[model samples]
Target: MRPKMEFDPLAFFTPSLKEDSVFIQDDSLSVKAHVQIAIHQSVTSERVTSWHDDSCDECEEEEDALMPLHILDLPMLRLQPPYPVLVTILKLLSPDEVLNFEPSNRQQNANPDEEAIFREKAISSIHLKNALTWLNNSCPRLNASAKLSLVPHLSLALRANFTNEYNAYMTRIVSNELSWMSEAEKEEVQSLASMRISENCGRMAQPQLKRKIHLANLEKYGREYIYLNEPSMTNDNLGLKTWGSSLILGSRLLRVSTGSPFLKEPVLELGSGTGLVGMCCCLMGMVTTLTDLPQIVPNLQTNLKLNNLENYSCAELDWSAPGSSPVYGKSFSTVVVSDPVYSSQHPHWVVNMISLFLNDDINNNSVLIEVPLRPSFENERQLLWKLMSDQFVEVESEIEDGYDDFGEMKFCYKRFIRKI
Candidate 1:
């Protein structure tokens, strides 16, 4: 069973992952996470140092105006209690939830009696004490000044929120090294960090069991299920987890299985990360071969077994060397892929891979594709389209609004009929 507690992003001062949190993995065990078919320069910006700066008086004043004016925005700003206790007392809520949230006097609720006000405060005090006791028991080392310096920055994070300062400040505390703690204390903190990444990035990297396959839309309904076990991230291995487009494509297959105009008959799911799309096709009574890189095949097999899909098969077809696979030169009615275009070379590689296995009968062959409309990969998406257009024409295409762990996003789905 999965643990009940993972890392909490907002208040990370306390360690809740475990007695020796599994989230704090040993540094030596890290895997090199490169993926076969998919794809940083560190740059330090020149700062406005006192020696280099020679801006005019007006510019200087404007800069000064941008600086935090109140004590609340600076290091001297005080929390009612000091050090570790302060965070618990303040409730550690987002500033928007805490600051200036109440409306005008006319819109206020009827004034509470002295008893009501006292009761609320008393209850809050009791909760705070209970939380503190838990914290002390869970983390004895936190009794010292370990978190003394965090109060001001947490305040600034709330005040400045999305500004450059806030991002920089947060990054400083959590990035490459936890700057606030000593080296001896880093491994403990890093465990939580690994278990709990801040936002969308963390969501993608964490091990997740996602129930994303649309059972409601399927014919088999509750009889068929997809349970994906995504493992923890290493470096660049994006294929371990099912991408958003896989769910999108799987749903599409289920929707059209009754009288699919686009399917060629037998299907080959290329880059079958987590085997979602191919398994969906097999469940629809289609012959399917799900293939990906050798490193990705084991997990593909796992997901296959998870859904009792052992009858269907998976093979390793390296996009860069498609002929090496057993499925090479074997024809399929449709060659399908979801979110496959990552590296710059992917466009040409994908086109070449399809040519070897996608049936040459132009009148009856097609490629079914669904990819996220990622802004960073706009060029790659366009290039893949252009390359596909040279050999295939779009038979059906639509842009659909969808969401994943990363929040709302747009995905492009298309059925491309092969041209002679």
Candidate 2:
């Protein structure tokens, strides 16, 4: 018999919070607008500096006024407590009871105190202790940081509770990095950063040369192509690593005969983890842009430069953001994504991103997606294909078996064009 897995408190807490978290991520415009209005009201005619300029007293005062608003806007901020608070709450939790609390439990509860009690107690678990230890050690050594992201919040909490100067410094660095700077400028700020590998997840830190390469042979083109990507942090974001479905998708795209739409048109890839599929498209003579979150952009840029592909470029694209105002403009006739569906909101967000970015040329526009069949993600996976079918008509599709993070798995590859 397969060994039983231990109950994970984080996992138990995640589903309950994910919908609200996604809500916050997608609707952050309201929060930003509120902060801007507050700043204008409070700091009329005050001397200001660029957000990255910390030495200016005026800038520091402006930030002090803004920080509280920023923290208050986070949908699940209250759920995230300082380490001491987390431990105390954990000590009071009954793991079995906490795990069993359903969404309906909230509706049935007449007393608000009961709900608060459950939320506080939910943090206690052996899994959380291990995760906390990892975070405590990893935060200081992290090569990059950003505000409004989880890491900085955790660092700030630690600083407040333990008064650790390093944590305080990390929080500041992340905020600086979030300032308005060109991607090139951002790279300069992180140039001195040295990344450390996570012992548990096999993730390599920045400035580390530990590289893994995956190659795909294109017999039709009489050559082979290579891709390089390093392992990512243990956080669920898989963009830092390359998966087998991506390699398979790359190979399949390369093997397609000449005069295909991909060969002649500009293509944009969403959630371009490791840039494997996009790099392959570039090799096949297509202009391509590979996009992901800001944290993953530096490493993705490194991989593109590693292969000496000039036709391909990297951009920061957050799918949860309003796609109509994408950081990178909408200019591509084709969009591609591989293994992107994961959370409850991912299907809607990913499809919405495609709709916003894809050109309106009906005969020429297309989208190709490769999905690994994982039982855990079955519901969301079905939702993705269903949503795609509603918005676009299927042009062609295929299914195959391959190796994924979970070992051997079956994968579906589908190509679609806009519905009339």
Candidate 3:
């Protein structure tokens, strides 16, 4: 068997990895370049000790906030056109037209020679009502996206007759309710319209953008993550967003997995929202089941499908009503949960669920938990630790500095074995 390699968390933000450190390909990730970033949680004893960077956590966060984003790697985040796609897009342009590859200009002025093709067609919309249809037909998708982004072309079509095209499209959007557009984009368009009208559309105030779409960008895991943040879904919709506690815990598990004794057979993750920690377990070849409340289960299953883990499992398990689940009586050697303590009742409920599902054994079974130290939840956090200590011996506890979309936070993770 090939020996496991040690990865220093500090080295991740650097420009390059050590050449001497041999890298191997994993099928979980689409490419090796993606291996540098992972977000999830799991941990046990062994080589997982170096996760803390008390003196330098700030520096690391500054360098790799939330996730390490580099300007050259914007394609990975789906922000910029990838080089390969750019090459394909460039083919749509004419040979003599010389569209400078610059991005900031929006469009370049067309030379006299470049206007020859449009001149023959005599660009103009039939009328204001059919402007979008004309634009759709006139502009080929690839050509418009890649080539011929010239002011003269738009000026020719929209200059005299098509000047009303902008207002026409605006009216259609407001009346039709463009659901396809993001909440943020639609809100921006509404703001623009209000400025033009000098008042609200009809109501005293316009609706705000509450829904957010997050792209996890897991090229490292060869997994696709499409998450929706709809706070309006429920009061306890915390499952919608992936938290940093999960990332910190997952990173620790990844770092120590080679010799870690923590990952016992048939791992079960409780409160597995968005299922990042569960995905980490599955990637490690552990038999894993990701569980959450009934409402959150659909997103969990969707994430599983996106990550190419159809063969794995996700189930609905409410901590408050543990026995209501078919899995309530089942036993797992390792049980994990992160950021589960939110409400006052959560401390007792989470501990109760862990005890019920985790196998009763003196030496073999373990429970891993990670939770952020939110200022509001200090009392609950303290109560949770006290309750946990009553039934399990705390093998290791560490505070990790972490960052998520909400920003930087301090998280405490604990490793536990059943008390004899």
Instruction: Give the alpha carbon lDDT tens digit for every residue of 235-337 in model 1.
Output: 4556676667887788887777544756745789989987888888877777799998877888888888878763477899888877678887789988889
Which candidate number has the best TM-score?
Answer: 1
Ordered from best to worst lDDT, the candidate numbers read 1, 2, 3
Q: What does candidate 2's lDDT look like per residue over 351-412, in tens digits?
A: 98888778887667888899887666788899998999888888788889875322345789
lDDT of 3 by residue, 346-414 (tens): 899899988888888665698999998776678889999999989988999888886553335678999
Global lDDT of model 1 = 0.54
- What TM-score, computed on C-alpha atoms, does each candidate reach? 0.54, 0.50, 0.52
Query: What do the candidate models score in CA lDDT, each in turn?
Result: 0.54, 0.52, 0.51
How displaced is residue 321 in candidate 1, in Å?
0.7
Q: Give the Å error, residue 55, model 3.
A: 38
Q: Model 1 segments beyond 4 Å from truth?
A: 1-201, 204-212, 219-224
* Structural RMSD, model 1: 16.3
